[model samples]
Target: MAVTCDLSAERFVDRWSDYVGAPPLTCGIVDVGERTRPTVSGVDPDRVRTVSDPGNLQHLHDAVETHLSELPDADRTVVYLDTVNALLDHVPIPSVTGFLDRLTSSLSALGAVSCASFETGERGERTIRPVTETFGTVFELGRLGRSLEPTDDQLSSDDVFEVLSSRSQRLVLRSLLRAEGTLHVRELAQRIAAAQTTEQPDIEQIVTRLHHIDLPKLRETGLVAVEDRVVSATEVVTEVEPYLALAHPDERN
Candidate 1:
């Protein structure tokens, strides 16, 4: 059985680089459906590859296989299968379950491991439950987002201090920095709440504190800003990109 894990692209790439004793590996983002694919800026254009219409399982498998083949034996490969939810949308519960069964089997055959991160409304939670129960690992990226750090080189002592000064602030900052944007506090809270597998104190209160207090301090440092209820990272690429490039370089290219 393969180990399944969920992490943001930053954390995943960082760990893979460490595990292989290599610089950062490039990633390819494939849109498995026919829609406007979301864009992730600052990601190297040369490093990214894409596949359209992965709704067809054979096409999905072939794309993944070809991508994996291109990597050096020592390099780790990650397939960001966006819209696992979108893929299942409108399908009957039993049909969705059957699809996952086949998808996992196919992935295993390709020597690839797969994991998914998604939001859960009560209705979505019902469908997600069985998938988690069956899969050995289920990670909540929003909750886990709080604990993640950019590669050491990517962050400075001031950055660490700024983040650690307040727990509420830290959580907000970490989430925005990871996503490369400001987010509504309510959304941030929901994400953090989900990532936490264990029960906790009032999450709403926590978010309130972050919005009132922590966010102000972060803004003073020019690390974050808020317009209305939304908060976004400030000058993140200027602060972290060089360090990321240094920490994870492409040897082949």
Candidate 2:
């Protein structure tokens, strides 16, 4: 199961479509946010946790802990908290840092993967300092698809179809699919790089292909459009999904 704090489920999928093909129970997404948005049709509603109060850090922290406890000690759990900017609007910067300190350490103890976003600013910097100091890997996102910095937690999946059908498209496509709003070519490159490899990958090369090639291929299928470096997935992506479902090895568990 996945736990998302302050991030919309649709936005998460638009940013990471591979979850669509993850193992049965493993693909669940628990949304801890202030309101409910439209659910992605192919997505299971039961997996989403819609909390009304997003400002409560302790409540959010406790909710995340409970979800983590339900998984096995070795299971690869992915906890994604959207931009810390929203939380900073309500919670103190130090409190947010302390909460992340405990939260990340707890996730590390479980051997789970976790990542979150932070706006770039003086306050954003202070809040993210402790987080960056603790997490070995951290980076900024660019756009072609969208800006999504996902951890490796849910990177493992059994179905290996649809979302994983095209090696050339997986990372780029998933990032576009999960975008909650406007997406750009540069930000997409950053998100894809962070998701697929640890070593620094060529951001320029990836952006070139998305702008000149992949985005056009996706456009041909009416899944997305790229004009002036801004990319948006068509409604077609969601409608054509049910037919592409792949059998997951763990579903038989």
Candidate 3:
């Protein structure tokens, strides 16, 4: 006899939601591409203690150490490290292996599952080695740019600003946007540090400035809804698509 199970995405989300609410712990996100946006929706906004750019393994390691304090003693924490299109340039085998070893040691100490997803390509082969050696589950997310889909989950304040504002602000916004919703100033700072790349400017001061000034400007414009450290995007796609088109006309197909 065959058996049926409710394993649809909605059912998975519902079950995951219940788990998040009952026992809280720190969950880490090592987002390496624009794909950072979707992983943000996987956990409760309140429970996400650390979100870092996996591009910098050292920073990723440090963030995990700091946030491990927030997890429950017995409840297992999980780390979702995503390195899709982000590591296509030079392959660093030693650094990658070292980071994975450290990450494995940390997660094992806490009794957590360290899940890593890599996009399939020559790069994926280079990237997945460390993750597969350390973590139990590894998923291949096909080629980059071909299957990029943003979740219908409400846009975070950071994502809205990214799609609407200038480049510098957009960088700052992407990290914050990926958080379940709003985030504390310190949390945003850590994320900015982790997500920093050569092309992006230093965001420490800008993050501070947002609390005092720019956030209000965005709120006044109805682009963002701010209540303390929490920020939500109020503007829908229709309002932002034109701006996006102006900024990135090449994205038009």
Predicted model with the maximum TM-score: 2
RMSD of each: 16.1, 15.3, 21.0
Residue runs of model 3 more than 4 Å from their true location after superposition: 1-54, 84-91, 124-131, 136-253
Worst 10 residues of 2 by lDDT: 244-253
lDDT of each: 0.53, 0.62, 0.49
Per-residue CA lDDT of model 2 for 1-253, tens digit only, reads 5455555767666656565554344555657666664575456665555655666777777767776676565356677777667666777767777777888887778787777776655555555676566554556434443322333422222222334466445555556655753488899888776765448888898888777777776676556777787888666554333322232322211
Per-candidate TM-score against the hidden true structure: 0.37, 0.47, 0.35
Misplaced by over 4 Å in model 2 are: 1-6, 18-25, 71-74, 121-128, 141-253
lDDT of 2: 0.62
What is the RMSD, in Å, between candidate 1 and the native fold over all Cα? 16.1
Cα lDDT tens digits for candidate 3, 120-210? 4454555556545554333334445322244454445555555466554443345444563466666666665564555664666757777
- Candidate 2 vs 3: which has more lDDT: 2
Q: Give residue 28's lDDT in candidate 1 (0 to 100).
A: 52
lDDT of 1 by residue, 121-202 (tens): 4456677786555443445445445233565434555675655654455556556656667678788776556544458757
Clashing pairs in 1: 24-248, 182-231, 182-232
